[model samples]
Target: MSQIIGNLSQIGGDYDALFCDLWGCLHNGKQPYPAAVSALQQFRRAGGRVCLMTNAPRPNQYVIAQLDRMGVPRDAWDLVVSSGDAAQDAMFAGAVGRKVWHIGTEKDDGFFTDIPGEWANAPAISRVSLEEAEGIVATGPFDEANEAPEDYRARLMMARERGLVLLCANPDVVVDMGETRIYCAGALAEFYEELGGQSLYFGKPHPPVYDRARRLMDLGDEARILAVGDGIRTDVKGAQQEGIDCLFVTGGLAAEAFGPDVEDPDEELLREWLATQQMAPRYSIGRLR
Candidate 1:
């Protein structure tokens, strides 16, 4: 069961830090959510640290650049802990082998070159054809919006036959690019596993991303932390697995499922939806604010 709330302030004081999701709670893919921004600034004013924890399949700098283009102020967060950064660490450490086949677009180039300084001595990883590679690295599809997981079935079948492991950069099956829904790398990874191939994830609902956030941010050992996001399977489940409290935002990806009012969720419907889910947040809100 989950209690529906109106704003972050109602329980913000209980936590010393917030592990906030970027896509739906703080901003849409195009711009920042003003109310969410103010809530975060207030959290910081009260001496709380805000970590923009995200499952975007790009390094922190690339994400920061996108946030800048979207006009999200830097004051709203203390640091960014992203799945791309964590996955990059694994890639450099040879988790996916040295020679790999990439399934992504040019926008995802940063995943290979924009890694952290600690990996300066990392081995020189090369991009090879599917037939010549030892593993697969998926950031997203070449056509994120227009393609489906099944679109890669033929190629994936080849990789499966060769026993290539896929390193998933983002574990979100799909996300709303404003009003349009787009598939992410997680969909392909899911499809690969369904075809009997191994897929490794470094994002939400997985340990690597949370572990990376812990290593980067100093949210004091005694600090009370709360995870906030709209994705039930990713954000909420991830928080639970990490042994932390979570606040579910209904106005994001599953806005319609919670009722007609995206700003105010219908409690009965929310509870009913939760009953069907394997994971439920302790608290629920229409939006981050």
Candidate 2:
């Protein structure tokens, strides 16, 4: 593992392109981290191609607007690709003229606004059996808090039995929605897998989305991309699996995970943590900023 004392500038040399994660690495969803933003600006000033990749269940434009609202300047990155964008493209690829059952919050429905198809509140709206559904597009968390969780499970089983393709718009299982921890569509997708169902996940930690971002920058797989984010499951694991380096920010997840006592965990502690998991990142930082 390599350690750089200060900001990203300390890391010598310039990369041809950079594939960055959005949520925790760029901002905490509420506000942008000044240091992180400056780091990106510095990288771009050095002529590095930066692509902001996020697992948000919204289109690229929506993600960009959110970044703007969070105070992250438009020049922070060159391009953006959201998990929702990939899911929407995939959905349209298969069912161009068919109807679909959208299982998500109203805010997420904007992804399907321009698609050439009809929307059904529930799978039963089309009088089509779960097996007959052209495809299942899942966006947000569906639980008692917001929606009925049982209804979500039942829909998954129906889709599986009918051999309907399941498309996950949000790849994150949960995120820090400001001070509140809320579940994402990824939680339901995991449960569906446990029940022997097939699902197509679009988001961080998934190779396809990363591949798309790389293509956008014209960078090959050998590019020295640093995946920075606060989520261990998505940012770290995703980077490791894709054979790239990573920088883990400790400001997200269970914020309690890092403290004066546990801060700067020794190599042994890091190894112990990785022993229980299938992947490990190359380095860890307190926070990007």
Candidate 3:
């Protein structure tokens, strides 16, 4: 069983650096959680370095701008690392000079620009149909609110028939927006794989993003870094694989699974869920604060 923690302060002394997830832990897509923002600010004030590691399918700069708009103070974190950065890096390294169909929202278009030549040859990215594409870069479903993995069945089938490779930018199966949980790019990627299509994932529960996070944090000791997030599949599993202590937040994405007062989750249910995953966090909290 994971120990329940009241706030980050209670376990502040245990870690020198914090690798915190951005989406559910700090905000719910619409706005920032005041308590969570303040907690990270406080953690930073106490000589702790915070890296806003996220699975957002956009570059770190884009995420920083979004954070600013959401009123998440710049002082709250020391650095930012995102799956978009990892995806870009991977694309630069592996997909250079290749053409790919961008399967995502209009808001996700920024992911294709400003490629640095120092890394790898910039590849040509298009929003054209499957017939014109050599591969696919799936950021997420274009219509998250009204769509599901099944909504992409036809398109994925077409891409699969074309023998296209898929690069999944945000490897999150679902995310909570207020009280609504919507399917993400990971779900589509999973479905595509189930259809015998080859897919590459770039986010939590994957080593590339974690390696990027570690490098961005520049923290020498992995053991001294504490990972904080809500997703059991991504955050908890990622931290465990990275050999870092993780603090799970229950009131974020998995709120419904734990029952009422999600901040103070039902221990038995939470434990059962963890048991199924064969993973556990060092500590659990209702929220990041």
The best candidate in terms of lDDT: 1
What is the per-residue lDDT of model 3 for residues 1-289, given as tens digits with 9 covering 90 to 100? Answer: 8888889999998889998998889999899999999999999999999998899998888999998988888999989988998988777666522577877898888788757566544445445567787788889998988988887788888888988999999999998877788888999899999988989988998998878777766766544889999999999999999888999998887777788996688888888877887988989998888
Q: What's the TM-score of every candidate structure?
A: 0.98, 0.83, 0.94
Output the lDDT of residue 287, model 2: 62
Worst 10 residues of 2 by lDDT: 119-128
CA displacement after TM-score superposition, residue 7 of candidate 1 (Å):
1.0
RMSD of 3: 1.8
lDDT of 2 by residue, 80-182 (tens): 9888877766666654224565667677766876442442332222213445567667787634145534557777787677676667888788777666677
lDDT of 2: 0.69
In candidate 1, clashing pairs total: 0
For candidate 2, the TM-score is 0.83
Better candidate by lDDT, 1 or 2 = 1
- Descending-TM-score candidate ranking: 1, 3, 2
State the TM-score for model 3: 0.94
lDDT of each: 0.91, 0.69, 0.85
